[model samples]
Target: MAQLGNIENLIAARELLTSSLEKSKHLASAIDKTGRKLEEINQRLPSLEAAIKTLASKCSLSEIGRHIDPTVGPAAAVLNVFDAVHMLEESLSADPCSNLFRYLSIVKQLEEALKFLTDNCGLVIRWLEDAVRFLEGNAVVDDDRYLLNLNKCLRILEELRVTEEHSLLSGGCLCAAYGKLESEFRRILMENSFPLPMASSSVSVGEQACIASLPFPVPVIQKLQAIIEKLTTSNRLEKCISMYVEVRSLNARATLQALDLDYREISLSEFDSVQSVEGYIDQWCKHLEFAVKHVFELEYKLCENVFEKVGSDVWMGCFAKVTVQSGLHDFIKFGNTITKGKKDAIKLLKLLDIFAALNKLRLDFNRLFGGKACVEIQTRTRDLIKKVVNGASEIFWELSVQVELQRQSAPPSDGSVPRLLSFVTDYCNLLLHDNYRPILAQVLEIHRSWDHAKFEEELLSHEVHDIIKAIELNLETWAKTYEDTTLSYLFLMNNHWYLYKNLKGTKLGDLMGDSWLQGHEQYMEYYATLYLRESWGKLPAMLSEEGLILFPGGRAIDHDLVKKRLEVFMDAFDGMYKKQCSWAVSDKSLRGKACQLVVQIIVPAYQKFLQTYMPWVQQEASPSRNTKYSAERLKNMVCSLFQPKLGMYGSNTCTNMMGNINNAAINQLSSTPAAA
Candidate 1:
């Protein structure tokens, strides 16, 4: 069975081998056929590739159709040249060394195509006409769509730049496109409602707010700038600047007119003159600031960034000069308004506003000119700013002097004092409390030379010093004019004391030197002495020999004459007390001392007279009974002179009266020897 199986296996193997050989033969035939076919394909590959490249160069009429206008019937064929050229570019990218000839061939073909289109094809002209019409249509639209056409036109110009025949054509188109762009921009400017919507966060009001809102929208300006940036020539810049100038001039005129009209509405008589002037000045300053800042930040910013960037020197120069001149003109006009009045005091306050504006202008000028291309213009404007500041300072000095002259009119009395003080107080507070340090310093120089090294010891404000001096002088002179010596002294003492106390109370007190206090003290002593002499000096005359006999006489002492003298002394005492009591002496210590002095002089003399004549007074009961001023009555009356409310008193009057009798006698006799 194994042998039989081996024989069968050998037979099967033989059959399998026979089948494998047949299959191998068939596979060899198939391989041979495939190898022959591949060899044939390899043989034709170069020609096939060249034919495919040629077909690729001419295959897409669709793409060509997209680029060329349908109106250009035959010139549409010229679009095929671009395809050929594109194919050559691809070949060149793949292998420049191998495809140099091909590239040259396609370039020659492109030239031939262009020449044919230019010479024989009306379709090329039709295509250009259609493109121009499309550009015109887009330009006419009041929107951003024109930018697309503008970009397309620029591309066309770039594409035609290499071709001499078409280069002039592009130039014409550029001219037309630029004209269209200018006309569109002009239209946009003319039709645009300038003064864009106010920001929701803005706090501006009245015409200022309106003016602030009047600037063109930022996006609009950016768009216009973008369009202008495309233009490269100086002549184009001139045209653009001309349009810009017209628009800016119109806005400026409107702004100025509006400002003037609003200013006219400010009625100086409607409010406190000083306050009103200040308000008007502040408002004017605000407007000026707005105008100046806008000119630099907005208008000039637009010119520099948008127009001047692409502008000619002529246009930029003219624009800058006009802008600066316009600002100066406005400033001059505003300054004229403030200076129109003869009252230089009012003008001084107004100059504060003007100076502030000038300072702001200086800062703004630096900011604006810092980035400027022109240094000469910057330096010139800087000098102009300095001139303005110096002019303003000069005006301020002149006006300050004039104001001082006006203020120095008549010396301030009680009626006129408030006005003077009000001015002084305001100016002083402004100089000290407010941050007007430089102005204060200048004012000090104008008014008086103060030692800055002695700032702490110096008077706080020179203006205040002047006012105080004036008031003090006037008060002293007025006091001197009083005919009554007592009243004059009393007035002087009261006013001077009040002034001294007030000086000590105020901020200005620290500035008053020790010399001032010392001098004031001497004045106080002098006035006190004068008052004592005027009031107390008369008391001794009333208590003369006719009034009271200090020594006793024999039998008849002229008791009726003595009684009449006593009556006269009583009458004098009552009148003097009434007059003096009504008068005011503000210093408490001074008043008390004055009272004591009067008492020392009069009381002791009366006490001595009464004591020397007490026995005589006891004997002469008829004379004493009829007398209104007895020894006790006179003592009570003398005490009441010091205490006006204290009427008649009893035994204590005599005791108290004689209590200080020795000291009073010595003082009275020593002080007033004439009376003794």
Candidate 2:
């Protein structure tokens, strides 16, 4: 079994060796065939290389000669470009101001040439940029010299572009041309622009006839538009825009100045009084309306027409510059000055007028200054409106403060209406007029909304009520200044009557309502009664029957006692007449009623007392010696009590009259038979 296994292993090893030898022979044969093919390929290599070289040369030559003019070679084309650049430089050398149309034509040619170069010479531009980058120390791999050499046209272009002489001819000359265009733009604008007509006194003239149309003539606008197109094409739009702003701004300012709307030159101190500024305020309103509605409106139209092809931002910037430089700031500044000036009740009315004027023009302001470029104007205008609203509101509330201050002043000694009272009532009357009522109502409503977080339509009425209440309190305080209770009551009656009489049938009366009117009426009546009671109510008591006695069942009268009472009554009547006669009631009807009240209280009582006792006293003496005042005389004296006895109430004549009356009363009393 071992011998047979050995024989099988030898047979397996021989079969494996035979299979390996067959595979090696096939491999050697394949290797020999591959080497033969390699030798054959090597024999054709040089000829194929020579053929490829010929094809590459032909392709390069074809690419270089493709667009070459048969008559004008690449060299001539380059020279032609240089000639075109030289011609552009020479054309730019001519002043644009001399002939702006001709100059603009030349600039248009330059723009077209630049655009053509940019479109056709992109690769040359990149190469030149790369070369410039390498020169500037940036890493860059240079392209092949043959490729670079093939594009001689583009290479020359790059060379011409980098040269200082070409730069001066192209960039520098074009800049000078743009500079000339800017000057021409300014000159054309200045020549064509004219001041707008002076504003009419009437504000209802919404805009001037010229404002409805373009301010510039058609030819001038076209010329300006042409110049703008050239400048825009050259990417010099900012220069043109700045020039337009400068020229047109001056024109707008001139127009406003012609309308007398140059508020910056004005001084508030030029006016003699706050009231004197009313005319200026009126003028301000009219001129401001004209400026916004006419001058600026025209300017906006001009900007739109001239820069219509330009972007809105550019035109808006130009318009904004013109509007601001043309005294719009000064107009608002003037208003601010007025609001920030002296605070007074009268100034409140002025501020309301200013507010109304500005408020009226709010839509115009928004329309004109709505752009981002006019943001400062919009903000300042809104701020001024706020200032006017707050200032007018503050001054409106100062009515109460003024009343409180008036309380410190002396009351009218003649029991007439206090000046402060009349001032307040008159001021309120003005405020409640048709022109100011709605405006003030709106202002106060907004003010309340800001301060109290609430709004009410009756806000103005409430404010008026508060002011009236303050005036009433002040009247009360003033009344106390009079030492005589009668004059004090008379003072209250006079002021209340004055207020009611002046305010009746007016808007203010309607606001105060019937209840308020009735209340004031009752107040006047109550004070009138007090005056009568205090002045004459006690006179009747002096004649009362308590002190008198009838002896033996009224058959005999006590003559001594009655005579002594009569003497005392005469003395009291004489003293009261002298002292009370000087006090005055300024209102006619009020004075009449007041005098009648005194007569009603004392005259009937004294007359009846005389009817009973005068004859008893007369039995001892004549009537003249027995009684200084008869019923008729007492009635006459009472009727004359409230009349102004001298010139004016507080005048020297009034003082002399009081002194003379007192002296006469003293002399008459001392010489009387009762005193003797």
Candidate 3:
């Protein structure tokens, strides 16, 4: 019975053990099923999160658009949304999932805001257009509101592009939006007109000055600049700056054309205006260059494109226009300025002013472009020189005519010949070689061996050649004016001698040169010879063979006939003395020489007449004698014939002739029958 009860206990313990084992297997299978379901639930979690992210993106986008108050102004609504998106972007950034959705929401709402700006806020552009239309019609209108809205729209668009890369919807490029804003901005600028800057200021300083009416007048330029700033901030500078540069360049060109630079009217007063035409052009250039450089400074990559498109054209075309127009009137005025107060209002012709102007122009152009620009105007330079010369020539012709008239109205002794010649030579000296010293030195060095042809060949210019010819012609005309050959010769001799002596080391000497000096010396000699023949040649004719007294009755003298012949000769001497004493011989040496020549001819013949008749002189000792002029008395009278101004040289010739006469008288007495 105990064994059977223990077996039952064992069987019950076995059954309990088997039941525990089966329950354990069931619990293991249930744990396996739960693990499978948990794995499946874990696999579905990412999809749920993705769905939540998509929903959050839509909701965030809805919130952003709702917060944008359309009732408030469009610019204000866009500003509110832009501000909200920025805060959301910062707060949600730690969770990439939320951040991604936040960024998408920002782009979507910003796009719609930009669309509002494009469609509804286009009233800003319309206002700009109206302002431009008013300006185009020659009436200025305020555009401050338009510009402000434009700036706001551009600001929002730029902020949107700056958000995360995936924020923008499909086909939404910030650059494309930039392109639209830039186009409208440029259109307004193109249509509007602004006055040239009228203040006296430098380029850098002027750029800081506000146009009292329009501080940022050219929104086209300003908008383009804003776009460049946006692109450059986003590191997309090179991709879009070139297009902006090209558009800005085209606008600048159009503005230049509208200014009518080519048809600009310049006058003397305009040239002399306080704000010169050049100043106006300078202001224009500064405005254009500032626009170009401002854009370039926003992105350094734009420098080359800016210069190629607009900078070079501004320098060579628009800048060149200012130079050409200003130079035209200014050059003529420059020529006129120097020539004032001159003889006939034309005597002083100098190219120095023109040369100085040209130099200034070159330096100004170099400075304008910082020595990087090149322009050619050689033909214009030549034309300027030609105009000066031609204008001067007209004045010269008038002066020459005046000189001729003055000379014709006066005698050779009036000094007009010398004065006019001096003026002409001095003028040529200053004009031809640019200085008078070289001409002065060259002329003073002239000598007998100087060659005329060689000297003329070395002369400065054709104008100089013509001037010298005129001088020679005047000299010839003045010399030939005197009726008496002796007086004519005297006139030429005095003038030529004076010129030759006084012109040395002077401007006239240089102009006349060595050959002229040598020729003058020859002229002096020729005239002196002619004077000798004229004054003295007639004295010998009075003592010709026909004039001789022949006493057929050797012992008796024909007292009346001999006395009459002596009186005839004395009367001729008196007449000759009276005439020559008044005639001028300025040089002391020349006066003495002339007196000696006259005495040599007259005294010898007179002595011969006295000697031939003196044999009968002592025979007829009447108180009123036929030969009344004793040798000593004749000598004394002849010495008194020359004017006191002739000095010792004029007296000595007569004194020596007296000695000859006394010796001849003594010899005649010795040969006579009375002395033997």
Candidate 3 per-residue lDDT, tens place, 1-676, comes to: 1222332343343333322324334433443453344345346545633543454445433332222222224334333333433333333234222233333333334444344334433333333333233223432134233333334444444444344343433334543433444444345434543432433444353345433333233433444354445445445554453343444355334433433344233433434221123343333334333322332122222233222343454324433333333233333344343323223321222223333344335444344433222233344444454543443444443444444454453343422224344445444445544343242223322311143323342434544556557666777787677677677777677666655665656555676678888788788778878877877567766645353435554455556666677777777777776666556654556556666666677778888877877666557657345555665666556555434342311221212322222222112111111110
Candidate number achieving the greatest lDDT relative to the actual structure: 2
The Cα local distance difference test for each model comes to: 0.47, 0.66, 0.43
Query: How many Å off is the CA of 555 in candidate 1?
Result: 22
Which residue ranges in model 1 land beyond 4 Å of their true spot? 1-179, 190-193, 196-219, 229-234, 252-279, 294-296, 311-328, 336-349, 369-434, 440-491, 494-498, 505-507, 514-676
**How far does residue 58 in candidate 3 sit from its true spot (Å)?**
16
**Which pairs of residues have clashing backbones in candidate 3?**
none
Model 1 TM-score relative to the real fold = 0.44
The residue-by-residue lDDT of candidate 1 on 277-299, one tens digit each, is 55566666666676666644565
Arrange candidates by TM-score, descending. Answer: 2, 1, 3
- What TM-score, over all chains together, does every model reach? 0.44, 0.64, 0.35
Model 1: lDDT of residue 335: 51
Q: Taking the candidates one at a time, how many backbone clashes does each contain?
A: 2, 0, 0
- Where is model 3 more than 4 Å wrong at Cα? 1-348, 351-386, 389-418, 431-466, 502-516, 536-676
Candidate 1 lDDT for residue 596:
67
Candidate 1: which pairs clash? 195-213, 195-214
